[model samples]
Structure formats: C-alpha cells, structure tokens
Target: MTRASSQSDPFRLRAWIKVLAVGQLSYASAVAAADLAVPHPIAEGSNYTDWSGGYIGLQGSASGAYGDYAFSRTTVGGRAVPSFMSGDGTGRRDQGTTATTIVGGAFGGYNWQTGPWVYGVEADLSASNLKRPLPSTITGFGYEDADAFNIIRAKTDVFGSLRARLGYSFERYLVYGAFGLSGTNARFIGNYPDIDTGALNVAKHEVSFIGFNIGAGVQYAITESLALGLDYRYLDFGNSRRFSLGSVPGDAGGPVGTQANFNAHQLFLRLMWFPGGLRVPPDPAEIAPHDPDDGNSDRYSLHGQTTLIAQGTPGFRSPYVGDNSLIPHQARQTTTATIFLGLKVTDTTELYYNPEFSQGFGLSGTHGVAGFVNGEAQKAGAPYPRLRSNRYYIKQTINLGGETEDVPDGPNQVATRRDVNRITLLAGKFALGDFFDGNIYAHDPRVDFFNWSLWGSSAWDFPANLPGFTQGVYAEYNQAKFAVRAAATQVPKEQNSDVLDPRVFERAGLNAEFEGRYVLPWLDQSGKLRLGVFSNVGNVANNREIVTLTQLGIFDDINTAAVVTSKPRRKTGGYVNLEQALTPDLGLFARASLNDGRTTSLSFTDIDQSFSGGLSLKGTAWDRPGDTVGLGAAMNGLSPSHRAAFAAGYYGLLVGDGQLRYGTERAVETYYAINLTKFVTLTFDYQFVNNPNYNRDRGPAHFFASRLHADF
Candidate 1:
C-alpha cells in the first residue's frame, strides 16, 4: 500500500476554482445588465443583422464528470486475484466518483442565416484538470504481515467536441441548440504494493472514450465583429470494455481489468469574433472624431500572439560534470501561442483571460547557468504541445478625480481613459512580472532581450508555480510622478514545484515596489527609478543546515539533505530597477537585485545576487524605424553559505556540479529585432557566458538563437 503525499490536496484546487467562479459571476451579472443599456442604433431601418460568416472564439468553462469505476472481473495469470479486485463474490463495489474543474479553450465555426433562422457547425478543444480519488475496498490480503491496500485515481486532461447547431434570431440575440460527438482522454491509475517484499507496484491504463454530446446556448451581438454568449453541454460516454492495468511479464499478478462509463456536463462563457462580418455603417453625425492622444476606446478587445525560438551553443570547456551541467554543443527550441481576451464590465472594471499553448524545452532542460539563456523556456518544459489557462484576472480602478490620461490597447489591456491619480486592484491568477517590473528597454523577451537575467530581476525569487504564475491580490496607487504597488501571493509547495502551498498565512509571498519618474537634471531626458522588495515564507531549507547535516554524515548528499531539513523559513530580498530614455530612439535600463541566500532558492534561479544592464536602440540610423537592436550583460553571484553548499556538492534549484570552482557567473547578450510587418517580427539573439553554473573550471560558452513572433 502506497500513501499519497499529504501536502497535496484536491480540495484546495477545487476551492480556488470555486473562488474564481464566484468572483467572475458576481461581477458578470453587472456586466450583463450594463450591456443592455446602450443598444446599437438600427441601421437602414433593419431589425436584424446578417449572421453569415466564419467565426472563432475563446471560452472559459466549468465542467463536471461522473465516472462508474465498478470492476466486473479480474484475472492474474494463475495467481488468485485480490478480494477487492475479484469482488470477493460478496458484490461489494464502489459506485462512482465525480470530478469537477475549470477549463479554457478555443473554438471556431461557420454560420448561415436566412430571415429568422440560423444554422452552423462548430468544433472546440479544451484542456482539463478534472480528477477525483477513488475509495479502495479491503482485499483481506497481507503483505509481509502488513495489511495490503490499493489506491485508485481517475483523471482527464483533454477533451473536445464536434457539433452542428440550429438557432433562431431575435434582433441582436440568437438562441441555439446543438448536438455533437465528444471525446475525452482519460486515465485510471493504480498503486499496489508487492505482497512479499512490500515494494511499490504501479499500473496505469488509458481510459479514453467517445461520447454523444448535446448543448444549448444564447449569444448577443455586442458589435458587428464581436459577440458574447453562454452555453451548457452534456456528454455521455457509454460503458467501456475491460482493459489491462499494464504489467510486465514476470509479475505476481498478470494484469488488472476494469470497466466503467463516463459522463460530463459543462457550462461555458464564450467570446467570439466574426471574420468578414457584415457591418451597418453608423450615421456620420453620430460618430466621434478620432483623437491620437485619446487612444482606442473599445468596450472589449481581442489580441493574439505566437512566438518560436530556436537556440544552439558552440563547443566549450568542461573538465568534469555534475547532475545539472550544460553540454558543450547543443541545440533546442520552444514555441508558444496565446490569446488575450478582455471584457470591460464597466468604465472602471475589466476582466481578462489568456489561454496558451506551449511546447519544447530550453537547452540542457534549462540548467547549467545561473543567468540562463532563453527567457521563453519554462522550468517545467514539455516536449509535446500542451494547452493551459495561463492568466485570468479582474482589474478595478477607482478614480481620485485628476487629469485623465489615455491607456493604450494591448494584451490584457483595453484602451480607455483613466484618472491620472487612481487606485487599481487586481485579483485572480497572473504573473508578478506583469505589473511589478516596468522596463521598456529590456523587459519583454519576445521583442527585446532573451536572457533571463536581462529581462527580469533574477534575484527577486518572486512567488510562482511551474509556469511562473500565482493566484493572489495586487494593488497599485498611481500618481502623476510616482506609483506604489504591492501584492500577496501563494508560493510553490516545493522548490520548482507546480503545486502551490495552501497555507497562505504561513507560506506565502509578499512583494512591493515604489516607482518614481523624473527628468534628467542636465540632459532634460526622462528617467524612472523603481525600488522593489520581496519576502517569502515557505518550506525551504537553509544552505548552512544542509551543509552541516552533510558534514555529520547524517545525509550522504546535499539534494537529499536539503529536502529532509526543510522548514518554514523566511527569505527576503530587494532590487533597484532603472530605465532612462537617452533619445527618442535610444534607451538604457539596468537592475540590481539581491536575496538573503540563507535558505534554498524556491521559485526562480539559484542566484543570490545579480546585476544586469542593457541598451536598446531603434534602427532609425539605418532608416528601418521598426527595427531594434539590444545589448545586455549580467553578473550573478551567491552568498557565502550558498557558495559553501555548492562547494560541498549541495545541489540547488538549478545549477550544481558535483564539485565547485566558485566564480561570479558573467554573461553578455545581444539581439536584433526586425519588424517584418506591424504584426510580425523576426529576431536574432546571441549570448556568451563565463563560468557557467558559477563553476570557474567549466566553461566560457557561446549561444546563438533565432526567434519569430507575431501579434495583432
């Protein structure tokens, strides 16, 4: 019998999803009513608009699945099956388990309308985290004098549907019903201990199935090109056949087989766009004149972007190797696509969601250097494409009655006018970098610098999960010349782990920053200075303790020692970020950050201190105003205790050679971005690292990269 880790709880995940749902709906009601207040004026005296075109949309959904896991029979070579598996002739069985989760995805279809009737075909694909644990029946079996038990788990990660729809139009609203074929990729995993040796035996079976689906919904045309809708869908996957739970040839029990039926119900809020949509030109007199400084004033906005990066390194020196060392010559690539969806509930309120697809890995699985290359590469990299909801948050602004300024339309932001002095509150899941760090010259990896240290404060150790996001609340008070921002968030449960710690009061992250803007005294150019501080309390181990444990022979190595010695400890740090505009086409940015380095690093790289500076220049000199060139360098260092741990073969979150020749890791990076069009850009990047992984004997490595990016 194997035990599940106590730190992980499914209820916590469900609880957060529930919080997100309640928060969204509570505010969405206001939006629904507000949407009806201003109706589009009828054009050409027509009561209906054309609904004939191809459309695509993004959706956020809540889904539940009921699964019957009753096992009908069991066979294991010549060995007698366990009582639980064989049902013991007593007919004792587990009825079922229900799984619920929040999901996000993309959909597209074509619609045709004639008079009051409309018809269409649609298809959608979504990623899921629907999972539930199953209760195991007593088998009346013994393993080495200990009672034996089993653990059963059921989960679904991906699902989709193809359907045909029919609807009736009522002016701007359309009510529809749909029937479709649906399928899900599911899994049933089992854990059993060896009856004699008490060793663990694992088995997993793919439990995917096809099903029939039915749904209905209503949509309202908010604009000629945009629509908002709500839908409910039901899917029934009939009983499945008995299948093996996987086993090797020489196992005591041959294999386990089980049968089950699955069914699901899903509710969705969809925002769609119609391509080549028919438009009723508004009366010229009713239209407002465009103002360049006023920016875009749309009720809602949609934007998307995709980035692909391929990087390689040339041969470098390496006298020895450790568990996490970069190879001399290597190549790797990563690709990502994201859709930014936003809705303005009111003049002061907005909701946003970003669904993303990612694949590929960083070189050497994102290790070998403290100041690593490839900012786009996630620590939890995947070889195959995976879809995930990266960000979904609500932003509310309270005006203090001052001069108004225009806010530009961009990803996660809708164009509007805001008070010069206002208080903004954000709640939900998002990356800390989105709001805290403001460096126009070196921030964004897709368009500017590509090295991790250059693009962000590497020593901050901000709270985040595997993909670098966290659920939390953030607030900012902005004035004409200064801004103050703060956030409290959940930290990862373990070092570089995707699971977040549920003990918010005891294990959380807090961050704050003060930004001041001013003009240079002599140059008369604008410059900004930002001071940031962060403190994290979590289950992290101190480097000194791990080193001590190793010295006493209580632990054989640093990796194992750190895990065993972990306790609730505090890690605090601060940073200075500065950016200056040298000219209209040239800018300079720099950052210096440091952490206590007493405990092991948690969410980010292992650098205890780092300094990076960069220069960004537009290609106006060459008459290519849309092009850019960047150059940056970073120096990363570790605290004395951290250095001692590394010298003693103590592994860090990243970077650790079996032995250490300590050195301040230094790297220089440069990139050139060529804007092929307003929506597309191609960039070439290169970086050189000295003393990779802080090991002086290891390398003076060189890296080259090519990136392609598109957005609209």
Candidate 2:
C-alpha cells in the first residue's frame, strides 16, 4: 500500500506541473498573436506600412503665480551698527506673504509617426514678464522709524527646449517618453525706498542655466487628421547662481545670491489634416505588371495644425519685491498661433528648412537697466559720478571720506568700458544609418562685438596683466534615463596682445555631470529611482594686481597673494544627487555639492570649500481637461564668503553694521495651471526665500506673481 501511494503522488505532481506549463504557454501565445495584429485602423493593402514624416504646430497659454519672502537679522560682533541697511539686511524679514503675477508666450514643434511606434525631435521657445511688491520697517542702533518699501519685478523674456521623443500607440491613444536639453534667460528687478532718509533705490540681475529634461505624455487622436496630447516635464537646470546687492546704505556691497530650478506640466489639444489618407506606394503584388500609368510617386499634400497650451513657471524668488509691488512675484501665460509648412523629399533622404516667427505679450519685464546698474554702484558707495571723470585728460586729486573711503583709490578709473553685442549661429545635420549614427561639424558657437563706450573700459587700455577675453565650448550626451556633459572655457590674459602672459593670469576649466534611473519592477508601473554625480575642474592665472590688493589689506592681508599673482591656481570639485519616483506623477529628489572657491586654482593655505543640498517633489492630477500642476522646494548652505555677506546684510539692517558675511540661504517655491476652456487657461505660482545676507531694508523677503493666458 505504501509503495502504491508514493508512486501515485509522484504521478499526480508531474501531471499538475505539466498542466501549469501548458497554461503558461497558451497565455504567451495569445499575447504574441495579439501584439502582431494591427494596433490602429489600417487601410486594406500591404502587410505593413509607415507614415514616417515631419509636422509643425503652434500653441498658446496663460498662467499666474505667487511668491513669499522672509529675512532675519543676526549679530556677529559687539560693535555698534546703524539702524537702516540697504539691499537685503541681516535681520529676519517678510514681504507680501503671497504676490500674484501674469504672463504668456508661443511655441512650435515637428514630429514623425509610424505603425504602433513614433520617434522625432522638437523645439520650443517663449517670452513672458511678471511682477510683485515688498514693504518693511526697521529700527535699531541710534536709528529709528526707518521704513523701506518697494516692488519686485521679473522678466522671463526667453524659455526654450530641444527634445527627442519615442512613443508606442494603442489605437487612438499614444504613450510617449522624452529626454532633451533646455535653457532659459531670466532677470530679477527690485525697487525700494528708505523711509528714514527718504532715499529711493533699485537693483536688477540676469542669469541663465543649462540642464536636462525628462518627461512623459499621452496623445489622443480625435479624428484621422486631428490629435491632442498632455505632457509633464521635469527640467533640472542645475544651479544658476548670481551675486548682487541691494542699494540700501548699510546693506550696500553685500552678496545677493539667486538659484533657480524649473518643472512643469503641459496639456495641448491640436488639429491636423493630411491631403491624402496616408497613401502607400503601389505594392508589386497589387499593381499591373509594367503598366505605364502605375506610378508610385505621390502628389503634393498639405497639412495644418493649431494647439492650445497651459503651462506654469512655479518656483521663483524675488525677496526685494512685494506682492503688489510693480515687480511680478511669479508669472504664467498662454499663447496661440497657426503653423503652415510644406514637405518634399526622396525616400532615401530629405532636406527641409522650417522658418517660424511668433509674437505674444504677457506680464514680463526686468528691472530697468538704468535702475539696476546705478543701484549696484550705489550699494558699493561708488555711485556713477565717482566712477566717471568730468575732465577726461586732466589729473585731479580729491579727498575720499565717508562710504567713499572704502572704495580703493588706486586705478579707480574704469579701465575697460565696453558695450557688447553677441550673436550665435548653430547648424548641424543627422545621417540616417542602419545601425549607428554620427555627426560632425565646425562652427563659431558665439561671437561678440564690443564698442568702447569709454576708453577706460576698453580691454586694450588695461595693463597687459589684465587681459579680458572669456570664451569656451560646452557639450553633453543625453539618454532616456541618463545624461553626461563636459565643457571648457578660457579667459585671456590680454585683450589684443599676441603674447600670453604666464604671470598675468589666464583661466581654463572643465565641468561634467552624470545621471541615471532605475525602474522598480515590484512597484507601480511608473515608479523609479535615480542617481547623479557632477564635477568641475579648472585653473586660474595669477595676477600681480590681486597680490597687491591682498598686501593692501583688501583680502585679509594673506601673504599667499604673491603666490597667486605669480601662477594660475587649479580648482577641482563635484556633487552627488539622488531621486525616487513615487508614482507616475510624483517624485522626490535630493542633491549635495562642493567647490574649491571661485578662482581656477586651489591654494592649500587659502582653500575654500562649499556644500549644498535640497529636496523636491513634483506630480500632476488628470481630473480636468487641458489642466496640469506641479510643485518643488529646496534649501542650501553657502560658504564663508556667502555667510559673511548674509551676516553683513543681517547686521547692517538691525545694527547698521557695514561688515558683510555670506551665510546660509534657503528657498521654497510652488506653481499650478488650469484650463478654463479650449481658448483660455489660468496659472498661479509662489516662492519663499530666507537669506541672512540679503541687503534690502525689508530684511528676509517674499515675492509672488500670477497671470491669465488666452489662445486664439
């Protein structure tokens, strides 16, 4: 009985295993067969077909956003200080808890589609202006009843993206993924009035960043000739850091720091038409043999497209401006346009040129140039008159006192006053290959022509020791889940001299970055974890003038100044970043970085180190048509120089201390976009910043902006 039972059990187990294997095989076969079937409606003819072509379209949108700014004061020394400070002060401060702004712009792109799959590249650009306000009252150090009020302004005259997309179609709906490079030109403007002294001041700054973008979207085909799509993009523009100070008295001459990152969700509805219904050339099997009339060439076809877009510029910091200030806290806008283009080429290859021109106006404008330039000079206590000489050829001796005493007396004249005009032209070609693709070219990336507004400002007028030609090349490779980039630049030692001075100082540097992503198979379909690393290395030529300044007690009386003057210094450093995707529309990211000071070379004795890190979150809700939203926040620690500036601004505000320390700076920002209808969209955004170094009278500050966009 035991033998019989054991034999039966073995047979039963084998039978069950066979049954399960057969079932699995059947399921695999079913799936394979289903995949082979046509994914989209097809015209009766050949077994396969391709409608691989390029297209162009136009889009418009509207948006709005709000910003919050905060500041605080801290004491560094026991010395008595002034009560009112200029620019950003040392003490804690807050501006319009929330300020609203408006903006708008236009965009266009090209695409190619095939059976169940599509691949193509696209480019888009836009312009916008936004504003906000700020107000504050300060009292301390023999000074009281000091009040400062002003508006903060911002103008994003430019935003652009270059991306490549790959997608799979499920009948009328298409799911796609994209990766690319993006850039933007943005500016900040601030205006403030000192109540105690009844003095008005203004400041402005411009900055740019280059980074990578990753995104996903879905497209729905409404008809044979019309389609609509919604996409979410996370743009990591790296760090766009700028240094500036407000025009307040004690706050003057401190570092004004700014950093920016952008992420957005966009939904677009488009209409498309093709002259001939995806015509397929005659298949040999379907055509009469050698028939003279059986030509495969297709007649000319015409297509048109129009799209409505909704987008947001969420995280912005304008501590110097208030909610209602003339300056916009955050700006959002919508734009609309129609595109018309023709396509013609052979099957083996095609050559085409698409020339596009568009115009749209939204809430956008930087601080006026005059106000920003003068404000910077005023903060330094140099002012315009102190920088210019009334008598061009006459030498005059004048006694310097008060704030002017801080200004270096030697070589005070502008040695190189120049108005620069720069233009860039880029052209490249792609060769289609069976396996690998390659590209090569030699072109002038950027060219600048300058007019010497004043002889003193001319680079040629400066001593051979102070050459001034800054130029370089930058490039990177971007993939679906990873990216890498490197760049090198050179700062000439002399403007026109053929001889390169080894002692005068020259600069050469390189920067690199790497990022990767890993999808979590056990989690939801969209979950992923990412990691990245970035580094930079460079050398800076030494300058005699710098050594002299150090000897004159300008830079802490460091003896290493002579060594720095004799030879260029070398600098090397890097950063690390990690991120995780919680869902299809949500994610968290963190990063840390360190650098060896601003100059190219590192002197072990004067070595400077900086570290910074932060977290960010982004996601979208698909409840409404043509509407999408996103949010992010970050905090960073500055170096001693940055801390000093922060401390200076803090103390200068509460105690009227002139000393500046660069301290820690932190910021938080968010944004949202909603579509009211096919022709209109609304956008809102806000940003909050905390800085111990800002020199504005309002202390730590806040900023906000918003906008309404329309499409036609």
Candidate 3:
C-alpha cells in the first residue's frame, strides 16, 4: 500500500475549485434544458415526460461473465512441418473461468410513443479487455524434438448491438427491456517458445462473431433532452472455429478445430441527449444528487488503468545493426492492463496489491538509446501473454500532531483524514521510482511523459530488478513544510534480472531524500524540490574493467563479462528534482543527476549523468479540460570510464554500435492527449533522438506513436 500524498495547501485549493466549477456547469445545463421540455400528446395532463425522439449518449458498464470453450487439436499426417507433432501427446480439452470487469462506449437510439407505451431501436459499441489467457505446450513452429510452453490469448475487441426496445411510461420515469443482434470482432494470438532451437514463434488470427443480446433498464428524465438511466444487458457470442496450416517440420493440420465462445452480463449508467425531446414535471423534492464516483466514499475501493500503444519509426540511417541498434521502419504495438487492489486494515494501516498483464514489444525491442522511449516496455516482451504481480505492500501512518486534511480517493489511496505532520512506514516489493523520483507532471507513462529519462532522473541509477521493481522497507517523516525519507533495498543478483541476491545484507542499495515543499509567493501555486542520494554495494561488472580485459584479450566482450564478474563494486549518485505548478492548467518539471562515474549501471540503462526538463499544459484554454499536452527534452552522457568501454567496441544491453564516435545522446519528445470521452483518451506522440547508441557516427532517429487508453 502507499501512503496518501500530503499535498500543499495551494494544490488542495486548486482541486476544490475545479470540482465546484464542474458541478455549477452541470446544474446550469439541467436548468436550461428543463425549459425546453417537450410535451406528450398521448399523456397530456400527466406528470411524466414524453418519450418520443432520437437520442445519442455515452455509457460506462460493469459486467460479469460466465463461459466455456471446448477446443480440439489434430495432426494431418505422419509428416507435415516437422516441428510440432500434435496428437502424439496432446488432444482435445475444455477450458473455463469466470470474472467481472468494466466496459465503456457510446449508444444512439430512436423511440416512438403511443399513449403510455414506448417502442424504440438502439445500438451501441463497447469494449472489454479483462480475461484469462490459455496456456499449452507444443513443439513445431521452431523445433520438433523439443517441448515448449505455448501461451494463447484471445479477446473480443469491439462488440456492437442493434436492439429493439419496448417500454411503459410512469409519472416521471420509464421501464424497458431490449433484445438485440450483436456482433464482435475477435482477435487470437499464439506464442510458442522452442527450447531446443532457442527461438520463439508467434501466430495471430482475427475473426468476426455474430450473437444475440437481451436486457432490461429503467430511466428518469432530469430535463427535456437530458436523462439518467440504469441498464442491464446480457450478450452471448457463439463459438468461432479455428484452423491452422502446417509450419516448420512437426506442425501439421488435419481437421484441427478450435472454438472460441463468450458471454457477458452488464449493468451500466447512461447519460442521454434527446434535443427537443420530452421532460417530466418538475418535482424538486424527488430530485436526487448525482454522485458519479459512487463507491469512492468507502474505505476500500478499486481502480484500474489500461493503455494500448502502437509506435513506429520511418527508416533512419543505420549503417550497421548491432545487438541493440533500433531497426529502421519497423513498427510494434503493446497493451497493458493493471488492477489496483487496496484494503484498509485499520485506521492507520493499509494493504495493496497490483497485478498486470502485458503484451507487445517496443520499437526494435526497446533498443537504440540509453534513454529509451517507452518506460512501460522492458526487454521482457515474451512470445506469449504475461501476467505478473507489479506490487504488494503494507503502509502504516502515524500522526505527529498538526493540521488535519482530507485525502481524496484515487488509485492506491483511500478517502480519509490525516494529520499534516506524520510518519509513514512502508515495506514490500515495489518500484523504487514509485516513491523516490516522483514528478506531478511527468511520472506516470500511462498519463504523462512516456520516456524513461523524463519520468526519472536518468543518472540516479536507482536499484531495480527487471520490470523496474525492488524489495525494500522505507520510512518517511513529513511536516507541513518538509519531508525526510530513507530506504534500504536488495539489489538484483545480475544486471536487469528479476532474481535478487540471497545474501541481501552483503549486496544492498540505500536511498535517502530531503523534500522541501511550498507555494510560490507571487504565483500563489504549489511547487516542490527533492534532493536525493543513492549508494549500492554489489558484485557487478563495470565498463572500464570490461574494456581493459578486452584490450588484453582476456575477455570476449562486455556482455560476456556481466555473466561471470564476482567482484564487489561501489556506486554512489545524487539527483535534484523540481516541480512547479505555474497555474491550475500549467506546470513545469526538471531533473538533473550525476553518479560516481566509476561503476556499472547494474540496474537501469547506460547513462552516468543526465538532465531533463519539461512543461505540461492542460486543455482548459480550449474548453476540453480533460485533455493535456506536454513538451520535454533530455540529455544523457556516459562517464569517462564507461565511455572508454563503448569506444573499444564493448556493449551494454540497450546500446553498443559495434564502433565508436562517442557523443552525448540527446532526445526531445512531445505528446498531445485528447479525451474522447470521460473514460477514454487518444494520444499522439513524437520523439527525435540524436547520436543513437551514443555513437556520433550513427543516426538521429525519429519515432511516431499513437496511443489509446481507457480507465475504470
């Protein structure tokens, strides 16, 4: 669990202002629309509003599903593609599971009313991405004699409904039931890794499914053209058969059939717009206040964020492609779903867990620059779908006595009151970046800057295992004006690996930070400054040592040295981070850091020194308040000793150009996010990278990205 952030007074004031402003706007709209209410000819003198017109709206739904799949596999002949020989050991099987999730989309409809009865037709487009993936073992695509694990994932991307509705009108409300024809576009992906051949295989296919839907709903009119409603819908998409052709040596197909089936039941909230439609007689005493985030007032709540990103770079100059060089003109897409689960164990204690599922690869497999573009994409892109626990922890908060303030509800946070002065203790497995190097304007890639260098002080060399997580215990003391924090974490046994050293006491990393927060006197807005220091003792290989050994013909290369080094190394670094809110709609952030230049990067990427700065602007000026745009730039430099290694044709995981003309790697990134609806956003991003792989001889690269994100 994470402690509630103690925000400055100015920040709290800004939040309340925004909330009140939005409420006022909604109320004003309701009042005006009431005056334009349409009357029902068939229900004259009745209290109910007329329900006869065309309407369009948006909705958010929570759905629970129950389903099953019975798929069969068969091989065509004794010899086809010789890699996988199905039927020899594997055959038909049944797979099933159940879960609940949420979906959001738009709906449009038309209705005709006669007396107290109403008839209509409606259509909607919605999406759901939460489900379990199936796992299998096979041999074929990559090799015949070796068995390997194969993971298969399938999803119903966008499902649409065309329904016929029938309803009976009440004094000021309506009750209706609907049945409809539904269609869905489904996608299937299979990944198999052959241990014998040391390679991975990926297979993909897409198909459309037609189904039926039935549901019931109730609605009440707030004004003539605007109404509030609740709906329940159930959908059944029947089986879709799949067939495959032989691949490699052992992959054969002979009447091999796989069927995909799915069903769902949803309860949704609807906001409808029916211009020149009907309205109910005003009943002030019966009007209920609208609370959008219903469960947010509770001590225990849930939140989630999912994003799908697709990126590509038009061919750039790459005279040669080394192990880590970015491939020109290549494109890739990735999707991630994270569930935030939190529980309040006591008034002063909380527990939280995060589980994530990710699919897709980064551009050129997350290579080319030491300051990689996608912070969410690690080198761990697998041939199959993956599920991992991102975080699990407990937090304790103790009041030291001071002013009391309310903490707003959000992911990993509870709606409660806390003292201005407090001490927080946290222990568990989590990402160091989550607590140490945080920035209001650039920290989370899901909503802010997507580049690693911009989100964190690149040169700090924070100790993190692969997936950017670490195990540790930390303590923080906070006052109205300042905060002090310290943490001790275990380092990974090897570079970028998930395994931590067992003898943690002998190979540990330490971090300490001092934070000073205040409001700019003239601006009357919040701003923060954090200065931090980090030190680590671990058995890691350094660039200088690898280069020296290669020069003496005692080692093959730097990559090889990382696997065998048992010598302990000491590394220390310091960083300065600042964030300032110039206005409610504008903010600025900057970070600069320098490390001891003498040791290996052990965890993150290859920069020993770095500087990054950026400004973020909210879309209030354009009247699209939920949208945002950001502009940022960063510069990364290798230490003298490390530079010597790269200059000698040695390499790190993300960079090594096969030759040398060392220069500082620089990057500039900008993105604009447009909120399509309250729950969905589309972002366009571009980045220009200079001195790819830290080699002056290599290209300046240009990357383009389109991102779609939805949250519940």
Separately for all candidates shown, the number of backbone clashes (residues 3 or more apart, or on different chains) is 0, 116, 13
| Model 3 misplaced regions, further than 4 Å | 1-297
**Which candidate model has the greater TM-score, 1 or 3?**
3
Per-residue lDDT tens digits of candidate 1, residues 558-592? 77998988888999999999999998899999999
Residue 317 of candidate 1: its Cα lDDT? 80
- Model 3 TM-score is 0.65
> If ranked by TM-score, best first, what sequence of candidates would result?
3, 1, 2
TM-scores, all models, native as reference: 0.63, 0.32, 0.65
lDDT of 1 at 59: 72
Ten contiguous residues with the weakest lDDT in model 1: 86-95
Runs off by more than 4 Å, candidate 1: 1-297
Angstrom error of the Cα, residue 389, model 1: value is 1.7
